[model samples]
Target: MLLACSGVLAAPTSVSAVSADGGSRITQVKVYPGSATVERTARVPAGARSLTIRCLSPQLDVQSLQVQADAHVRIGESSVKVQDRDLDKECATPLDDQVRDAEDRVASAKAETDSLELATSYLRTVATVPPSEPHSGPGTPGSASINGTTDTLRRSSQDLLLKLHQSKRRQEAAELALKELTEERNRIAGPKARTSTVTITLASDREGELRLSYQLRGPGWSPSYRAALDSTSGVVKFERLALVAQNTGEDWRNVQLALSTGQPTRSTAGRLPGPWTINVAPAEQFTTEIRAMPAPAPVAASKVTLMSMGDRGAETTPAMPNFDVQVSDDAYATEFTVPQRITVPSGGQRITLSLGSLDARAQLVSRTSPGVEPAAYLIAQLSALPGVWPAAPVALYRDGAYVGQGRLDNNSDELSRTGLSFGRDERVVVTAEPQQQNSGSAGFTGANVERKVQHAYRVESRHQRPIALQVLDAAPVSQNEQIDVVSQYDPLPADKAWNRRPGLILWSETLAPGSSLRFTAAHTLRYPKDARLQESK
Candidate 1:
């Protein structure tokens, strides 16, 4: 049924509905990752016998449909029906407009073709007129005059022929488009009506509101964010947004929307251990949840000078792009309530709306993996986050300049902090010195093979102010008991096995303008000469 034209049903229809029936509109929607729960409220006068909510999406889950009324009003059994709209002619559908558009194009193209053909025919007739006796005098039409007239007719005929050909081609294209649209309609409509209706038996003592709620399949939302940083103030303003869309056949106008983390559409029952004999394994053994790659370590380094905080330097706190919203954190879900009523149309277009805004001091730091790349990256760290910041895309602004985009992955065991890299800082250059490696026999009897690797890295800063830089490198970890790995760092690293990740060395230092620090790490691995030891990438 006319998805393009489908609107809120003015009045719900029911066979036994009384005059007490009233208009119903979707008042609230709780949108999850893949589905949404829709709640529609209808107010009826006293002594109402039944209520019906009409024009529901065919994608709704019938088993989850429920109806309730005020305590005084009793809601009885409700039934969902997929009824066919029996009409003398085709009920209006979304494809009808497209079909008519194609028809108009075809008719216009055919008309143009007909006019061009007529003009071409007249020109052909004039140009093909048999050459009569040529008079060899002026004003009597000599060969030159005949030639010019012939040329004009030939040019006109050719132009008209080209026009006719183009018009025919357009006409064919329009006809084909019409055919495809018609076929699509026939296939989707499938000789049946797609409208839906829900009827609930109710007995009301006084004027009360009847709430009908159901789960729909094709409506969901995702989070988006825009963060602006003021370097002088170390303050960051965040504008939180949600991209919401629905293909549920009816427009949700003036609805109270809540973005929810709850997954009601998913199963709550824990998976029980199935009968498993080692020989006869269960069809589905186990499941693994692949977490998103964490954001770079919470390193806070600012491009602006540390002593410049008092100046403000034309960098007033950025105005936060925001909306009125309320956040509710329950045990099962954290929901953000959109304060104002919003409308999400049913054409599957993502409508962006603000969830709210927050202001916090951003901790900035520079991090570089000198072993892997020769550039240092500036990162902004946020220790305190919004009540609920899901994994989404982020647009960053630094010192009033647009930097770039980054993905926010907050699924960390440590929830107190998150970081976003603002791309590379060309001012800080990292140089990896040539590697030194050698192999030799270490045991007294030459029974042990020894491998030694020496790596040196240099990091220099070009910024006017000192920047806190952290260089990441790793020493090899051996799996075998007999394989011994020894690591030595020049001026020892600031944090060994940083963040509990074994063998990962993090070196932290403040580098001044034009100043550099050289870091050396030596790794020696010894194994029995008879055993095979392989290095991995």
Candidate 2:
């Protein structure tokens, strides 16, 4: 972050010539989910004529570049130009010391390998000396002495070979380590590290600070939440975090980072409805016709119309969703200022930053739809969330143990409270009896069919304390006048439309320890025998 405030130029005369400067650094960054804005400031002495901020990444939106200075300093518009050479050496990752250490390790390993290889070669050379007319003395323990010497030489050769083999392996490993580190460092300083220099004409009567900021499309951050529930306290500890990353060929070192909910990269205006006009139509009729055109034109470059890439239609592939919940978040804009400075390395590597934490009022309830799932799920009904929270996946923990993942559905402008679901609770058992169905033809010579279905469910609580439980089920609704459906329950449900879901009924009560309850629903339908019904997911 040498760009934050790394330079101070000596006072120059009004006629001072323009020159590039490196004494500036990224001071602050406001990162949205898809784009980021970077601000750099530098100190300038009185009489300074112009300031040129050099080695800025080319990924920034040049049209968004702006220059601001003290009112005492008059400044002209800033212009950006692509630099002809490589990026500034300072723009690379701040891992030079690490890269050097890796290189040293490689060199040391190579040296050890070479030493071992030299010793092995020398051993081979000496082992071939050829006995040299051994003494020729009478009975000098002839054959035994020769065998002993051979054994010694063989043992020495084996040891040296082993040492050489191990040394080579170490050398290879060291080389690989060096390669990885070097590649990581170069990845941030590679060919895509093209840069641009922004020069802003200025005339200052006194010392002041020159600030330059621009919007970039590379860096982004997304909200991630952690919710931990303490059943005894009936409170959920909700923590906010952000996954931040960048690939702008520059490292963000301890910069003031702010996460904003505003979407500057999206369309600024709301979409207008196309049309709802209705028109009278003619009677349907089939018609066929054939039209032919001349399509033989070759070698006519002069008559060709030149068009840019923008003129061509582009096929954009839709992004794959992280979850099955297809929800559009249109909440009011909000911002979270990270309490501490953050650092995220370049190369799309993410680092999680903590935003803040708050406790939310929560109630734990066991709920189940026996027809859909035969087990009751533990749900945390939450209220009083932060002013605005975008829909995001939440990591759940109960009593310090990870429960599972949950979804936060408070992303709508009109919605406030959101419910979080934990995995099923086996302690609260649910049983759905077989559905009883009967059908028969009725109404004047079998003109219509009558069908009746009866569903029964039983729930039991094994908890030592009383717990609130909700049971839900949906009754069939007829869409056509020819079909008449009537639903009846053994005991009227507490809510006919549970959570605003039509046709879904809810049953609620505080179940005592080891207590059980039973409920039943019956539906009768009468419809034309030839009519068919379609099932929907």
Candidate 3:
């Protein structure tokens, strides 16, 4: 006897044969990837009865698919479920295949419409250029006989001018088309592709050890994994989650995937080395949870004391915490003096070593100093400079090897100690000496410089207040190869544009005693690249 089997039915091509295992004939089956999703409808024939559906893909193991007799359907497994109220009504529509064709045509129409709009805009702008006035008056000429000759010349000039204007109009039209295509491509491609959001969350469990939970979610679906933290040290943990795709389209087999903590929107400017592990979690839903483990007794921080020694070999000044010292320039030769017998707490503790103000000088003596000129040996000199060789760099060391940089100053006010490595003897030494700078004489040199091109450069004072620097680049840049200027330095406002000033390529700056500032500016060049290399005559 024929029995009603919900909405499932057999296709009309063949008759159902009785099987030895007493089972109804199986028909259509489809699979999707773990990363795909579906929202619309699939049609079921009227005669089909008793539909048996199963999700077999290992990547996306489906829990269940709920089929309704009339007006509704729900899809998902027992663990995850989504019920659709209008699924039955949507499925009843005829599948003529013409609807898909219509969608494509509509998309094409929109593209053509946008292209036409851009062409119209460019034509309107080109029409607005004022036409050249016709030169009409008594021609200044030799005589009636010369008039014939001049008339021929005037006709040829007018024709050439008209052609040039037409070429420009065509060029403008081409540029507009290119811009419109680029905009449409970006709109279709959507936002830039980026890494998927995968997060591991930590939590404390009833046991002494830490527990972990992992959550992964993107466009299609979300899946989670759970694991426990490491024993003894309850802070660190690891976990993995295997999520089969729920609604990936057919042909969902092998694929490539990975997880990462991408750069967040608000990243701090200056931070310590090692990975940027944020103290707080952003808007992320993890599939896994991690718990804290029992922590061991805390260790003390490392410390070193600085003691002043007198010529008699006895300690003159009281010992104080030895902080790490950094330099304004690492290339500069330096020396660090460390004293023995410093106080440390019972547990392991960390401390910093700092270098105070010291006298330093640079000299240009003959590689083999000739006894002739001592004054000539004085190349340049500075005295009583504080802090490390490199300005505002952190001091760090590990296994007697310098590791990474840390904050050099606490704030703008005073130098601060950058925390040391906890359970190791990491020490840094500085050797004091003078560092030579690359010095040169300024001269206007180079070839692309033309007599017509503007040439300029700026030179400034080191420490004094507002000093004027002159702009020198003014000649046509073709033959002259270099631009040079000499003057004192001064700080300028950030928002203001300095390069726009006539014949200027650089700005000057000045800093007071122990104070410093930095600025960046953009320059606008008036000449073409062929003239850039020309030096000022």
Better of 2 and 3 by lDDT: 2
Candidate 2 residue-wise lDDT, 1-537, digit = tens: 222223223335556643334377677888776788999888666766667666676686988888888889898766777653233553444455677888898898889889988887766655554555454565333334455566897998899899889888988988898788778766664544576777676777777888888998857777778998887887888877667777766666656666776768776665454454544455583553334444544421111000011111236743431211111234666776654455655666666655567798777889889989899988788654755666677899987889888766564422222267767778999999999999999898998999999989999999999998988988887778998988898777998777776678888878999999999999999999898976453
Model 2 / residue 108 / CA error / Å:
8.1
lDDT of 2 at 486: 89
**TM-score of structure candidate 1:** 0.72
Runs off by more than 4 Å, candidate 1: 1-23, 42-53, 69-77, 83-193, 201-210, 274-322, 384-386, 411-418
Instruction: Give Cα distance to truth, residue 161, candidate 1, Å.
Output: 7.9
Candidate 1: residue 291 Cα off by (Å):
25
Candidate number of the best TM-score: 2
Against the correct fold, how does model 3 do in TM-score?
0.16
Q: What overall lDDT goes with each candidate model?
A: 0.71, 0.70, 0.26
Identify the superior model by lDDT, candidate 1 or candidate 2: 1
lDDT by residue for model 1 (288-390), tens? 4444544544422111000001112235664542356788998878898876666666656567777778888766678888888888888777775747777
Please provide, for model 3 over 1-537, each residue's C-alpha lDDT reduced to its tens digit, 9 standing for 90 to 100: 000011222223354421111111112111111122211122333233222222111122232222222332222112222222123221111211233344444455555555555554443433332235332344322233233444675675566556555555555555555455444322322122111111111111111111111121111211122212121221211112212222111111111122111211123354444443435445595444444544644432111121122122235654553433222223523323222222111111222222333322221110101111111110111122243332233333322444443332322322211111112111111111222223232225432222221112222223233322211122122233233322222333321222344333232233243332332222222233233343442
For candidate 1, list the clashing residue pairs, or say none: 299-365, 300-363, 300-364, 300-365, 301-364, 301-365
TM-score of each: 0.72, 0.76, 0.16
